[model samples]
Target: MARPTLLFCGLLSFLLSCGERKHIAIWEYPEISPSPEVQDYFGTTVIDSYHNLTDLEDSLVQNWFKTQDSLAETYFLNNDLTTQFKNRFHELEGRTSGEVRMIRTDEKGNYYYLRYDEDKDTDVLFYREKGGNLETELFDPSSYTNEKQNISYLEPSYDGTKIAIGFDPQEEFTSTIAIYDVINKKFLKDKITHINPDFGEIEWLPDNSGVIYLYFPFVEKSDPKYKKHSFSVVYYLGDNPEKRTPIFGWDKTLEIASDYYPKVKIGSSLDSYIVGYAAKSGIFYDSFIAKITDVKLGKPNWKPFFKASDKIYYNQGEIREQYFIYRRATPNGNELCQVEIGNPNFNNPLILATGSRENPITQFEVTKDHIYFVREKFGVEISIFKIDNQVNITQLSPPFVPGYASFFGESVAHNNIGIGMDGWTSNYIRYCINDEGDFTNESILDSPQFQEFKDLVSKQIMIYSHDGVAVPLSLVYKKDMKLESNNEVFIYVYGAYGESMSPFFSPTYLDWVKQGGILAFPHVRGGGEKGEEWHTQGMKELKYNSWKDLIACTEALIYKGYTRKGLISLYTNSAGGITAGMAVNERPELYTSFIAEVPRMHPFGLESATTASSTSYIEYGTIKDSLECLGLIQMDPYINLKQNKYYPATLLMPSNSDDRIPLWDSGKYIAKLQKYNLAETPIIMDIDYKSGHENSSNYDAAMDVNARIFSFAKSNMRY
Candidate 1:
């Protein structure tokens, strides 16, 4: 652990009690505060170390983590099925497989693709045949390891004969793609080495002209000073390297010119399929499809489609010749549409189905008659809507009752396409769609990890908010676990950028909840709860609404006799970190403590800060835009610290390799508060070295965090 240094001296702000609704014994807070000073960090001239500490803290934290990261790395790298977490969550024990993500297919009758291990360096990929013939293989990524050994992404070609493989040794080295001969067991010499590899898409052109080549233009910062900027070409390689071309064309009015959520847009005609790109305009990345109407390879020439944070999933199987059903976004901007094909000349895209305005329209598979897409709601509800002239809709899941994370099924693919539905409380029954469009074999994909959790005698509950708003929260304390009003509690909230915190079972969390701790959540604004408006409402000027709603929920927790002050904690990262931090500062009375994990908040007084593309620009008006928004005035955690006298003991953390908020935001606040804090509060600066934004992925790092959090709160928030 690193030590804290004092820079200034001032009186401590008077300590106050927990929120008015709850009570707890109190301790003294330091009355001293720091004076401002200018310093240079990472070559950037930060105006004042007191307010701008991103650079300084980043450097120090990075160094600290580098020295101590090995142990944490090994702890999490241990992929033991019986791997134990400190706070065992009883509800999650049998319910989750600990398999982070997986995918499935209909060709093999009932097959699925799953990640073999949690360790990236030694991970495996398993292909379980529909009838239960599981084949396992080591998928090494294609880095510069002297051999073609890597699996950055896996996209089985449309014909299933070739798999497009994308892998990179490191970011400094551009990712490349290769053709893995599925049937012949050979690597193709005509490998398409692109700037970045994609696992979601592949082209099976009519003539086997090889996969379409795609590329993009990228920019890299010279130093942290923000003084010099340079650009680089992210090249793409296809069939004939000699004939291959790099994509470079981009229009500012039409393109976002960013790599945040970059994807190659491909348009298929009767003859071939080519590539295109999208740029970020905040959360929305506008899409452009490749117009191979001409021979030259580059960005699409046709007008762009709407924007999306993720790819609109389409079926890998073809729809006759020269065309296939593609997932299209709602032109009216409400729900996503299952169009036949955007290209008007080929086949007119019929509105086959539409998802709720809240969740983007997902593309699963296209049959002669019905189209399958999950109708999303408080919980995921699978609904098979008809295509073309049929125009019929059917619901798949039972009506949601509350206290359930989501009714969404295990997304074997990005769109959760062609998979059976589950309400989180039950085992998943994975069925297949036969050639005649008949469904059969409702086999259970729920592993032992999931079955273990179902033994508990608890059911899901839907808790309504003050406005008759049904906030879906998953709750499972021990059956013997006391529902005592004063028990310890923690809730995680991250509601922005179309991000949905899935209700999958986590062992460590279950252990904690089972041990008499109440683990809960609030499906609040600034997320995909209701729709785009829900997220927009909690972002920017209205951003404070998220924090306020969280605070309201916390109050409701105690009022409903769920938990008491000095016994409850809040967890959030990225954008939710801002919400958690602000709530802690504004209403210190409600929280026992809070964790600001890689907080994505404006460093307030910090200088030269970069933010996430989605909510950051909206919440914190950028210097480039120059247009002032009310959001910039509010939602500043560092700025509001001076007025926060009754603040909770905080855990400030950031990853040095984190590309988003960096490390200074947490540092600046701590450096300034050390002087003025009157409480016996310790500013635990949790740092990770080699880790990127995935601060919690490492088991040891997560354990260290849990230990630190336990110690911090046990010592300071004790009643």
Candidate 2:
């Protein structure tokens, strides 16, 4: 008898391959694989590692890249590997996921939220109706968990009179929040659309009739094309329907800030005022205190809360169009000050922080009694700083997890306070100081998914950077899990621009930890946690301060017996991709593998955003300044792929239609590595088709990718 042939052998085998599957995406991308034309555009030469005298020689990049196929085919094939790895890792990671929706208070003042149950394939809204008596109802039902369209974005208002519901129906798109009046049990005819951009937070103004706060983006009246402009307008509830005021709008003349926008953080105690940041371009994001005294919008009661200017050009010759040369760029960044919001501009705005390495202060907020903001430390966690009569920096946890904490994307309200601690071999708890200034409560609200693994320890140590700076290191290792003094480790770092990571709690315990994994974090001089003083250590092409810091952490992890060099792995996302790719190029011995997921690796992709893209200026420095060219050269990850060494086996994960980072990053980096790298490492790629900027898909799809990541780790670390 002839051997039974496998059904659809080639096609089925490809589908069943570790990376061939798809999953439920949180931020679903319409395009996972790019067109051949797009791939052709992402051709590359090489991104510098250390910039040696003969770095340009063909021999330098020979083995480092795997350029056997056309740029498109190489990325397509490699992404296949990445997907298989992620899919498997997803399944192995088990049940924990980040899918929280509405967070509200119960009758007894306890917290409640909406959660999506993947197993049940339904959206459930739970409310703390009574003491310990949580009431839950099925909100939405689907065959599988949704990727981007989540129920959490829809929130119910106080007294249950109304609910603000978000609706993003189409793929690679977003929808508006429709008010569902519970009392009337009907959908309110008057809807607020095109107010705040999707991902913008929604706060109910005092009056139940309508919203107190409105987000009016900058409108280019002259250009009827509705050009994507910068600026924001705050709307009040009592406006004469047709004449709502634009709380914070701007004219194009302001070179620093072309349009209008709102602040990153917002807080409100009454229907009276909402304090936030307005879009006034340039380096400065001055605070604005908008007091809604009346609903009749009157030129938005014009006020200026904060403002600052930066050097027209960075050190790399006016910062514009300058090819990035590591370790060189403008020394000038931003100087932030507190602005009194009541006039055309903030009066007596006190300077809070200055940008030496990159942008000055990123996030700031006024809680019940304190003004809290994060200062970008040079390539580390943002030092939690409080400003009142004097600036007080609080260490919430050991410097480890990236500082900018968000329990959920888009929504900013989260309880990210408290501290977590663990011993080298045991005991982990989240600790925090109460208002009275003492470690009052334990931060462990939820138990670890796998405490049996021993509480992962996160501690700080000093690491040596290339420039000899004593970098602060963050480490998390399983407690008493039979780990060798120098166990195989996975060092994760993101040292680009001035963004500092923060430490918070989560159950992101996944497949790697299941098999005895250790994580390492480092804060180098390229971030802003130390204030303008520290941030200055990295910026422009001199931005190497961050790269140096990342490498230092890897070397430190190995030297301190936290890990073994040849068995270690490096994992990073976005800007962190720069860290992983560059460090592997510079110090191959420190790492054995890497994961560069949806990184902004393509330098040329930093081309200016069209008139309609809202986030055009956030990642790539604002293009108006001629000097940002130098900064891009330095900060863009794709521009700095290193060559000339035995690179770690790297897995590149890029969303096919990534809007934020753009797919060019993955395409160009992969192309360059293929054509360049001196080491012939297996540069596997996981190009998530049907997903874009976000690696979210339906439920089954997500778990599959997670499963793959775990399996990949196991397969690669036997050495």
Candidate 3:
């Protein structure tokens, strides 16, 4: 059963009887006045025609969206090809799920996890005790609110009596944090509201008295400008839960040029430790150590732990014994360092693990006897290693696995570590390391039959970019498939925020490959695949390199006879959406179909918007800067499209509830693109009202979205 608009059952019936694409009428777009807004940016005159569309609440824009939805509904419902693709994707998705594995284990031997119940068609949170036979259902998000609301973050207390869970209403940026009592399976009266949707890092005190969390006062102040600053607050969770005392923030008396509140993290063992980075930049940080024996006794004397300079960026660390094992960013890669708890001099900190271009520590975790870390090589493969205080490194995991592994959630005591891992040909699986040092793994959900992929082959290959850089591409396809230009291919890229799109398994991608299509993942610049140097090469003024790298990957695939022009489709979301939008705008001829989910389209328009966050300015510099302005204009997909040019069959998927990048961003971009495109190819804006930047883990919701996307892809292809 599905919504009337989705027409799930009707489409299934149509799919079973269909043989060819049906003639569906494509409605003409609603007429809107060409209200151009001109502005002078550093002596450059920029013209914006869809300025009126930016007002998402405007009657005109709302009416336009309704009309577009009506058109899409009619076109998709009537087209037999749409039904066919939906059925195929639905079947494939039914056999697999994006199961949320229990990422953390508490000292009390409790393992908290989330999984989709196929019978219920929703995701449910469950926790099992160390020796318990039955798994207890902690939270069923669907029961709390509508299907759209899901548990975005869950952190259990050290003692396991309480747990902090963040509930995110789909499409909205803010989340509601509530404390839950484990034994009773009930929520406490205390609720912490207005958390930053992107960053909800919270640390519970060892005493279980309160939590240390980052809070932006935008909701309380109700001022748009207030969003620029976020401070750390200690909220005691007893009878007086209302008392939220600020721990670290704006000391106006201190004559410092930086923002008063930067992103900070707190941890405690023998003492409390905090690592803070200037919010203005994601790079460097300052550390403080305090004896937080009593969280309710106001504040304690904070001693200097390590004063971070511009050169070193603190990732994460913890205080164990008298030494601190922390990870810091180096020139080439991130390294693990050991320092005294209250070390006044930071220069003499001992290097526990020296990181380099060849062996970069992507992530690390602290244990009593040993420090466990993941080192990545060749930008795709990762291996786990552990080192003791004796400076001896031992390989815990095999040198190579099919996919990469990373920290899944908060770790529990007893040396138990949970990891989330997947590969191009692999399904998402959860692995656990027991106290005895044995690695155990289980599929997150009932994965699709792996036997189907026995004929498939996946590997990583290098392709030279425009600037002679060897960009890596991860590809998966049927081994017996002919390497001909006729083969259909799907390419994905996201090269921003130094966040790499790893070679992970996807049922959607596997469905395409199973249908004789090829899936290629371009490990382009702008991502941390090759470390910070690769990221810096494609950021700010050099942002074009990201899309350029994607284009180069496309060309190389075509040249190698994996696919031909007009046979390949590209997909990306968020920052990756920026990469996809830019690539399609620059080289429309290289692709037949393009899908951008919640894309960062016009940087100038985005920066000028009232809803834009000040913290985002660091990624793509402010508009006031001349070079940044020029780069934003050059990369603006809406502005760069040529009039009367034939673009690819484009799908712009934006979540109506997504506050991160407002729906209007995609709305305005689609409107401008539709006006400029004279070709018969479709430019569709598929808006999901129930999803957000982080899609739901619900099984049905996943099926619905995949059906829509895969159906569109199927309709655009030539048989």
Candidate 4:
């Protein structure tokens, strides 16, 4: 297997008078013998030449990836810009006290959370007492195994005597759940394997004697149904996991589809009933309620709580004594509603709180005395509100104004709540609200303030899209920076699955702004920035709105004198690649370069018989339907690439272990781009072998990746 070589042409000066420079290098891409394949969809024939790359077992494919990786290594070897970004990243990250998340509080006021361990370079589980000023180390992957592992999920028991922790070794999607005795300070004999920490819930029983969790039947990545057909099962303490039968899932009930994911939810305050829900990759869910006693006796009678047609939001509902509180999609907005669990009537439920288009309810949690929910005003400002037993709504004042806030780990038994808040310019801090509604700072660690971030400013503006739709765009830059077209700009986009691009503090953004670069975030239609309608407008047949909205925002920025056409870069990861890829394909002259990390570049490939295809057919649309097939073809970046067209320099980053979006997707896209690109700019594919879809757990490794991205964007700037 011969590796590709980089042919460095003579460096041409673009703006030597202004002291700005760029290297002109022509890269010799790896030679691939494409095995042409064709597929017919509703009388439309599509030809794919790089289809052989999908076979991971092919030696030719493996060699090609290795050659491409070597080419990237040779291109970035000892580059001064890369080294400068790496050093600045280290200086910025070292000043902070790491990060803390997944906070859970037990009934006895014991706090459990995952905190970053600077020495081990991984997040470790820590336990803090009610009034203690110090945190005690509870669980570290280094203590149990030599392999680097991460704490995927944590759920403390109701009685505070035991806790369940899900650990993913080496960033593998396959996780295992283990029980730890809080009082005894040791791990129990109970262990459940073949669990996915990202998809479902891990609920503890009311008596603390058992746990119900989502389990996957197939663990081998080679299996066609590797991440499909997930079901919920109960695991008793010290019992054999193989002997347990599923209490809710496709096999247990005829109501659930084989491809849909099933999960179980048990309220800590209620010992009588449990909730079971099944959903694909959409906001709507089909939910049912069953008695706990019947479930234990192995004759669970599942009664319909709500159907997908009812428009109930998944993972947004909580079970109270005899009532189920949830937020449902309405024409106005997402309405907070409650229904009787015994006789669930979703058609005419009791509306506790109603939201408008201007302020849509985003998240909610049910406590013993009240129900708390968070609302967002066009994805910019966040507000918290509460509803009492008498259905009286009141807005609660947070510690900070115009910041992101959400309730987490609310104990129904103790009526205690944890609120995590942060802004575009503020560091994340946690607050504990007691039963009497008093807020107290319960943060276990404090992040150091940097002068670079202190001098930064953020502004929210609305830009009209191609369809005359107003889309929210966020801008962050140095306070002293002027709106000059000469400045470099970076746009980050992720508008899919009804997820919003919310405000949060990050040192990486500050680093870019501190270097006199502007960062832009567009709240496109596919996201839940406005409401459910906003997401539906950009899905399936209307998916083109997402990329068009991004283009509109970018054009508006340039017209407003924020940055010039050739000085801007587009950055997107995962599903956001759809927007960025299509935007670049439509208007390549607007950007100097673009980076796609673990992106889903080929929508037609997603229709193949894979786990992602089955689970995500609802969001991306299935080829079984003619209309949806047309929509998928329209948004397909790989299929839309024109021959001999001028394109910006592109850096495609694909991780070897990313099961969500395999490396072959990026490999095929880059191959086509490199073959047809008319510009002298390079189309590079960088591979990360150790990580999956998520970033690396090792601090230095993650920093190195970020530095490469920053440097790559900087190197391509025309200036």
Candidate 5:
């Protein structure tokens, strides 16, 4: 064993406060004074007391936050049960199927890629010489002075002389971009700060003189017009950062064209055309394009790129010369459409490729010579193909693993197409496809040790919901494990944003499975698993479908004798937090415990959200609308929570610095739960001071969070 084994037998109750097990006392919650605030949505009056918690900058709220975090740290971290969980996690952390993500090569053929290194405790950037097999450590984010800071992105310049890296403190949404000299292996003094780490991206100029990126202002509260908006600027290396020229934003005319502000992105081609996306509603958007030369000259005659249509919620594409290859949302699936650059309207658009709801184009990449695309069938099997300039489609041959791949265009040799894959039950592989359609994978890193997982069984099952909708479920457990009502089970869900949960090997999850716990992933509606219609059915007014689907799945599991109510726990984060939180509140008896990390407790309470922008309103709908308010009232976990309820033992993980979802959402949620719950069920709030929704950047800190969560689930999930 890599770690000392602690006695875990009979200590489960001590770790998690299981029902009827009074071994652990319920600690008193921190005293929070209610500041009632009311709002009138048409005729309905909504009252809020813990609303003040949303004011993160308020002196009283800050003090309360500090006190609550301090109390949580002492209550959750400094304990024997946590130590045991950490040791157990360390035991399983080594059992991994390593992955390589975003493999790229510079003009000099120097290869660069990010590798998930368990031993290093953080993802490290590795560099390989043109033809060398030996990989050199280019950047290890874990070596930062502030242990919580981690590298978020890496963008190598055209000439490969400089690699622009963006890093941020863990869980937070702010990033700082620093230029690194690839030859010198050192970072430059120039740094670009106030970047919206999640959505912001950097692109180097063709000449390699500078880069174009976006940044938000450093203010306590953003201007309403500029809320969650980033201004694009061109930063020249070794030049004064403050002197960077702003190329985007300050456009009052463009704001009228779309409800949301547009962000700038440099196209993949050498044409140096700047693309802008202004999302009007949902996933559908209107885009604009302008040349780099015009923007540099301070004129920037922006022209309409993709015009939005009411029927299409998603219209995006890559600009290839005078033609634009677009993917538009269709009734059955996303279909590819093309239009000439100087077209007056999309009245005469040509359909290039068509797909159904089951076999949709998940992603597409445009290279100089070909357009590569990945088509997913039923969210399980994936197929890749390429289309040449003459519209000749060619499907690559066998050894096609079911996983995700990223294409990095053609290499310097132009004879091969650079590709990287994240496979199921396998390590990430980076290779190239030659003109002969043969894959030549270069060994850049060693495969992860997964010998222990050979005995585990992975299966896909379908459970019928209350409405008879067959929701897809993925289950993984030891082959010898028996299906029983007393078995501990964890259900993970993310029922929003059309995001599909792919089956990938995770040491943390494998550890749980190794310990006889069953892991389940329910591909419920609101995810892209079944396409846009599936997502639409579980969002906005129909949002209750997400939670209802979760409940139905849970009940189905219990009915099937997989696990009893008191033996099952649920885990959800980000938007899924809203789904899981609401589901548990609606059916508290169905779960033993719950973990909601960086949750959006109150979608209607946008005032409390960190990045409450116009874009979010499109997803959750505006609170000012009576119809939306009614739906929000029915689905918002914070609003639906009642006093004197015997809620399941719940752990709320919130970071103090998360700018995407905001920590205040969790603060106010913990306040309400503590004030309402009268049962001994622990409503523990584990607050990370430096982390946010994404959790800690430091591997140790992140592991601690996982240990606490896994331990709580293991302990509380006992009958």
Candidate 6:
């Protein structure tokens, strides 16, 4: 008689023996209709078979998504892990107090911030006056409408008499501006719609009579140019929003492209001049300044302050007295500079503080007495420095170190600044820095202390890539946990737009370490970890460096005996899709599973006439040029998939209402993977019908998705 075969293998047994027989679930992928389409990119013919899946409006695509969602649900139900993870996640979340963000203090010492309300299950705007013990509920999204809404942005007038709040419906990009009278305790009748606050803030005039903001012409998502052709307009109190005057845009006298987004910047309420500029994705753009009086008269004479040829990145500089204090790009790094506002000279300016590659200046603020700036080293350690009128720099000794720090609030008038600091093992704290350089705890919210995270440890190590480049990799796990080949590792990646994976605390991440798992964060080339040079090495024609760096980091983990092959998982979202997707495609045996949320798997799709494509062409090359088209093809994950290849299990979470990345990118990529992969692993696409590119604001909805992700990772890594 033959020996009885085991249906499921134990974790210890599977880890001890490489030949252990583990039961792997072979999912029956849903059948998708193939609508073959071919495109010629400078004589290069690329054929796409699952082009029909891009049309989410099609009935066949809709049914296919439903079927995939059902299959994923059944898999999770059969494994019986989602509920366990959900309960554990909730327990971990309950251990912490609500979060507070966008904290602002007016000249009158009134504090305004958005705080998460446990009872309301959403963030609520709260206001507290000077020397007040009680906080007042200024605006509640729950009270506004039955549908879920969020306060995207808020700005208090210079006089602290009125507040401009941008209210955005959940899963939508457009926002409406509403003015609230702080003294009167009521909202104004004038309502401004079709406003895009993400591009800029609500800049108030010196007298606080109105606000200057970025405006969008189209309000309906069905419009072809819904988020395009944005212009800066001024809306006055008690005036019709339809009659708002356009100050700066491509249609105006300004020399800006149609795809360039225009924004207005008012340094201070006392300043007489305002700055205007047009940018594609970054701050390196041509900027101009004009007198507020001339702008109000609709006959402004715009003078060039900085041109795109200068390669200067805007940092919200201030206009003090007769001089404009700002930071400009230098060969070494960023340097502080000041020029006369009346007759600005870009060719030369007074340099105050200089930065080096090791400690580059990240943010700065101007005050009546001094200029304060923050610098970072290797994206981990932060230092706050102040420059005197004599160009002397002094580093302030804050209580927090080995963390991130940023300056906020109006420091020019009050001579007081708000500093936010947080680290990987520590929670976020707000401090008020006085003119005398004294740090005071100004946090209004309190967080609960959890014992489970007491033993958590984070280590920063540099791993050499295949090309001999040292990539910074961050590891987080229990301090007493033993490092071995059988350890389960989860690697998170997002290496685009020069965004850095800075240190920040998250209870959800801690929950993973609280269990016996290792969390890894690789500061790859495309990010701003090292500086602009690091980003340049991983973008456009050099895009392969990003994924190549990830592969090196993953292999280093296995070689270092921290983890083994088929025991690690890779996860990423949005533009980082290029990094994670390509890594898994190149070496599928390294990871047990892959998870992507709202991923940009198809880079060629960025050539379409969409807002995402227009702004992103600066980061990722466009298909219009032959050289750039070849680069886009090389980085396109969907186009690089191979048939008869063993691919790890993949779970793709995409929202139908995502305005940033189209659903087609995820749809087509997963459809082809499910059809071509030789492995029996599942390729699932879970669609969120009621959310956008930004994660869902609904607490339960976010928890549900996170639970599924963790559960899927756990189930796959068990073998």
Residue 5 displacement in candidate 1 (angstroms): 18
Which candidate has the top score in TM-score? Answer: 4
Q: How displaced is residue 475 in candidate 2, in Å?
A: 1.6
Q: What is the Å distance of residue 46 in model 3 from its true position? A: 1.5
Name the lDDT of candidate 4.
Answer: 0.81
Superior candidate under lDDT, 3 versus 6: 6
The estimated TM-scores of all candidates read: 0.71, 0.67, 0.90, 0.95, 0.88, 0.93
Q: How accurate is candidate 3 locally (lDDT)?
A: 0.69
Q: If ranked by lDDT, best first, what sequence of candidates would result? A: 4, 6, 5, 3, 1, 2
Best-fitting candidate, measured by lDDT? Answer: 4
Query: Which lDDT values do the candidates have, in the order given?
Result: 0.47, 0.46, 0.69, 0.81, 0.70, 0.78
Q: How many clashes show up in model 5?
A: 2
List model 1 lDDT by residue over 17-115, tens digit each. Answer: 332222232322222234465544334343343542333445544443332333223222231211333233223432443342445343223332434
Question: Candidate 6 has what TM-score?
Answer: 0.93
Counted clashes in each candidate structure: 53, 116, 4, 0, 2, 0
* Cα misplacement distance, residue 48 of candidate 3 (Å): 1.5
Instruction: Report the poorest 10 consecutive residues by lDDT, candidate 2.
Output: 317-326
Worst 10 residues of 5 by lDDT: 1-10
- State the displacement of the C-alpha of residue 235, model 3, in Å, after optimal TM-score superposition: 1.9
Model 5 lDDT tens row, 629-697: 677766678877888988888888776666556667777778888889876776777666666555534
Overlapping backbone residue pairs in candidate 3 total 4
Q: Per-residue alpha-carbon lDDT of model 2 for 381-464, expressed as tens digits?
A: 444444443545454433334444321111112222343333323223434434443443332233334554445555667777
Off by over 4 Å in 3: 1-27, 96-102, 139-150, 220-223, 226-228, 250-263, 268-271, 277-296, 300-314, 344-348, 408-414, 434-437, 442-448
Task: List the candidate numbers ranked by TM-score, top first.
Answer: 4, 6, 3, 5, 1, 2
